[model samples]
Target: MAKLIVSKFGGTSMGDAECMLRSSEVAFGRGASLVVVSATSGTTNDLIALGKASESQPWAEAEKILSKIHSRHVKIAADLHLPTESMQRLETLFEEMGSIAKGINLLKDCSVKAMDTLMSLGERMSSVLCTEAMAQVLKRHNSDKKAMWFDVREVLRTDDSFGKARPLTKEVESLSQKKLGFLRDYKTVVVTQGYIGSTEEGMTTTLGRGGSDYSAAILAEGVAADVLEIWTDVAGIATTDPRICPAAKPIDEISFKEASELATFGAKVLHPATLLPAIRKNIPVFVGSSFDADAKGTWIRKEVEDHPLIRAMAMRKKQILVTLSTPEMLHAHGFLFQIFKIFNDHKVSIDAITTSEISVSVTLDDSTLVNKKLIADLSEIADVQVEENLTLISLIGNNINHTPGLAKQIFETISDINVRMICLGASKHNFCFLVSEDQSTQAIQRLHKKFVEA
Candidate 1:
């Protein structure tokens, strides 16, 4: 029996009619029973812009955005020559989206919940187009299989977290077995939307930005799939971002731990949370290009043949370092707890942290700096000094902490660069530090040349 495969195509792979058709061919060739798709390229951003304009801008401006979105999808539908029923389905979705935007405009409020509903339209629309494309492919090949669209929100249950909803794994697993287990029949190719789920109360919620990959992994785990394939524009996972280092090579295989670290530190190909479900179920993931399906892609699994000390490095920019100093923290038990509690209450996740006798410094996404209340709360407990325009450079590999002279070699490679807030010993797979944003590229180049290229 063939393995049960769940394949997900990224936005670029679903950018246009031709792209969707190509991705459908790849999915069919790979024997993927379940196909997941993101919105066409730039559609999500346009949706976001439409929501903002509806809330604050004139109705004319918001309608213009809505028209742009409609035109783009209409062209795709026209190119595909979808039947009247399919076109009417898309028309209904468009009308629903326009109604939501008009409601937001009248209320002059775009709540996170409302924004999730708006953003979800992107995936919902693309899934319809992709299902039509898959049907055409099946017909072209004269296959007996049928193509159908599955509403993921029915099974992908999540909390009402709005913009960044969390999936209830057990509930998703139970629902998947009940609703999606039939996919094993290999008779119907089910195309579903990624990145959006529904709360128990039936309100729509999104799994955050770049969450379609996570959505694929969740569904893969839900059905106990043998493989999860992520089809994007890029050929495969490289030693580094190829745009940054032309000499970077594609990694044929990587372990789950290394891939997780690489993603958390800022690899754009995979979302940070994408691997959690796959890892839990020990499902192997394939990252390949939908445009060039024949290329040898990267495979992420539990173990690989080689475990390099420094496999790959990733850099995340726009980081803010917050240093909290209070003499009360010196040998104080609850003081540290209080500081963490405040951050937890604010829902700001810390990336890297270091503590001294009286001071604790943590790295956060620069976006969190907008929360004045979080900063004010921390200021009440300690003298808070926030440093902006920092970058986090992470080295992902195996035995990074156990290996001797690794840090020395790393520092020696970039001896001239100023390194701040070193985080190590916590994970054997990651060694991360902070540097000025302006110097990050130079740091990564020098480090990559020394570690990866060498």
Candidate 2:
């Protein structure tokens, strides 16, 4: 039996007609049975802007963005030379978007549900265009079979978390068996949207920003795919962001654990949650550049032959460090518990933590969204200090904590830079710390040179 491969193309890969055509060739050429696509580059952001405008601005303001969305899709269709039927469908979808915007304007409310629905449009439209483009390419290549645009909302079931929903794994598996189980029987390519899923009640919900990668992982596990390929803009996982360090080198392969650490800490190659499903299924995951389809890219799997001491480094910027000091915390048993309870109640996630006898400091992402309220609540118990514009630098590999000289090497490399916080021994794959945002690039370069270049 031919193995079913699930390939996901990121937004940049689907950005324009030319990009979509290139992506189609990859999908068709690779014989990917299932292709999940994100919104064209910038489309999701534009949709989000439209959602915001609809909530507070007049219909005119919303209409401006609506027009942009419509015109963009129309141009893509014209560029793709879509059939008249496909062109009419694109028009209808645009009209529906306009109606949605008008409805939000009339209601003066952009509820989470409404936002989800609005955001889903980008992927919906992209999937349609991608499927049609792939079908046309297959015809051009003399293949009789056509690509099918699949509405994955029907197969991926999730809870009602609205913007950041969680997929019900069993439900997804059951539905995939019923809906997509027959893909093996036919020589057809299935194209579907990423990031968006439906609740059991059929309400639209997104998996969150960068959730498209998560969507692909879930679908890969659900359909028992032999391989899951994540096609994005870069050459794949690198020692450090190439933009940050020109010397950053691509890692040919990495373990699932190391990749997870990189994604969680700061790497943008894959959504943090994308590896969970693949890890469970023990599927071989490939990260490749859609733009450079021939590049070797990176492979992520259960285990790789060689385990380097420090495989890569990732930096997460725009971090906020919150330090809470209370005299009462000294020798108090429940002091730590109290701090954690506040976080749980407010649903604020901490990225890293450190503690002294009377003080505890933690780092958080999306601080702008959670800091003010969290600080207000936390202040009731301790004196709070918030520092913004920090960055978390992480060294990812095997036994990094136990590896001799690694700690000294990292600190020595950045000895000139102020080290705000150091977190170690939490994960075998990572040794992370906090530094000023301004010094992040220097830190990455110095560390990459010491470990990767050396």
Candidate 3:
């Protein structure tokens, strides 16, 4: 069996026919054995909206969205000059989508199960289109072998968790061997859908939004591939979001630990959990731009040659700070446990935490998904103050906690910005603080100049 190279392309890379052609070149030109593709840009959102409308809006309204989605795909297929049989197959998929929407309207309820199935359609459709495009590109180059569409769900089995399913690792490995093992000796480029998995019962589920990267890592590890390539719109991971700070530069190399911190702190380039499988397998991961394949991108591995004081900074906006103050919390041992237990029971993930003798402040992402009952329960233990529209700024590095002068520089740079809460000692790699959302960009730029540019 030859060493496999698994490459994953994000939605923007597969946005249209031209983009698909470029992505195919990246896959085949770079000697990728398997290619995992996300949905065309905006297709998943449209599908979700159509699903929501099925529950409340009339069937006609949902059909309108379905028709729009179908037309987009049809146009792309025609633009790519796909065969008549392939175009008919594309229409068949659109027909299936219409039937699914009609069923959702008739039921008047879009369960998580139904939504996952609908969302899976985006990847399935995109995979079909990409395989055709890549095959054409291969033939044009006079390659004897063509790209093949491999159904990933056949091997990437997971639990019954419909919306955010957890992949069963052992099952995935076994199935990958049984199904993808043949591809090891084959000489064709295998294209598959990302973010979609199936349970043992064969019910379709999703790993979550941005799970396509996770899907790629899973396949690479499952098959023991040499390297996992994540092709996105940007050149690679940057010191900060380029949009927030235009001076932000791309990082050539980073450690897995630092990359994980950046992902957790709100870097959108890679999913936070995408590196777990690759990390365990010791597979080096590459992040590059599909639009500009020749550009130098970031490489994530177990170690890097250099470790800077502040490698990168990330800011997560729309944070909610929950401050609990009570005399009982003063010098109390079990008080902290009680508060944490409530968060655990509610399944709320905290981004940052700071504590005083009599109070504790925590920040969580501001989302409607937060459990209201958790807040109501916390109010019983202590007086809770909730602050909305805040931002979390994380300075990520290597052993920055013990590094002197770094903290001094950070404070001096953002001396004027009001810091709400500071969280340290949680991880050796990061020093995070909360601030008003409006000041986040200014804070990032000042910090980037002070640390990254200097």
lDDT, residue 171, candidate 2: 98
Clashing pairs in 1: none
Residue 165's lDDT within candidate 1 is 96
Best candidate according to lDDT: 1
lDDT, candidate 2, at 51: 91
Q: Return the TM-score for candidate 1, rounded to 2 decimals.
A: 0.99
Model 1 per-residue lDDT tens digits across residues 1-454: 8889999999999999999999999999999999999999999999999999999999999999999999999999999998888898899999989999999999999999999999999999999998999999999999999999999999999999899999999999999999998988989999999999999999999999999999999999999999999999999899889999998889999999999999999999899999999999999999999999999999999989999998999999999999999989877789888989999999989999999999999999999989999999999999999999999999999999999999999999899999988999999999999999999999999999999888
The per-candidate count of clashes, in order, stands at 0, 0, 0
RMSD of each: 0.8, 1.5, 1.6
| Residues 1-454 of candidate 3: C-alpha lDDT, one tens digit per residue | 4567899999999999999999999988788889999999999999999999988898889988998898888888888988877677677778878877888899998999989989999998999899999998899899877688888999999999788899999999999988887667647889999999999988999999989999889989888888899999999999999888888998999999999999999999999999999999999999999999999999999989998878999989989999999999776689989998998887778878888889999999888236778889999999999999999999999888888787778889999999989988878899999999999999999999988888
TM-scores for the candidates: 0.99, 0.97, 0.96
Residue 249, candidate 1: Cα error in Å is 0.9
Model 3, C-alpha of 271: deviation from truth (Å): 1.1
- Candidate 2 lDDT over residue span 210-258, tens digit each: 9999999999999999999999989889888888788888899999999
The candidate that wins on TM-score is 1
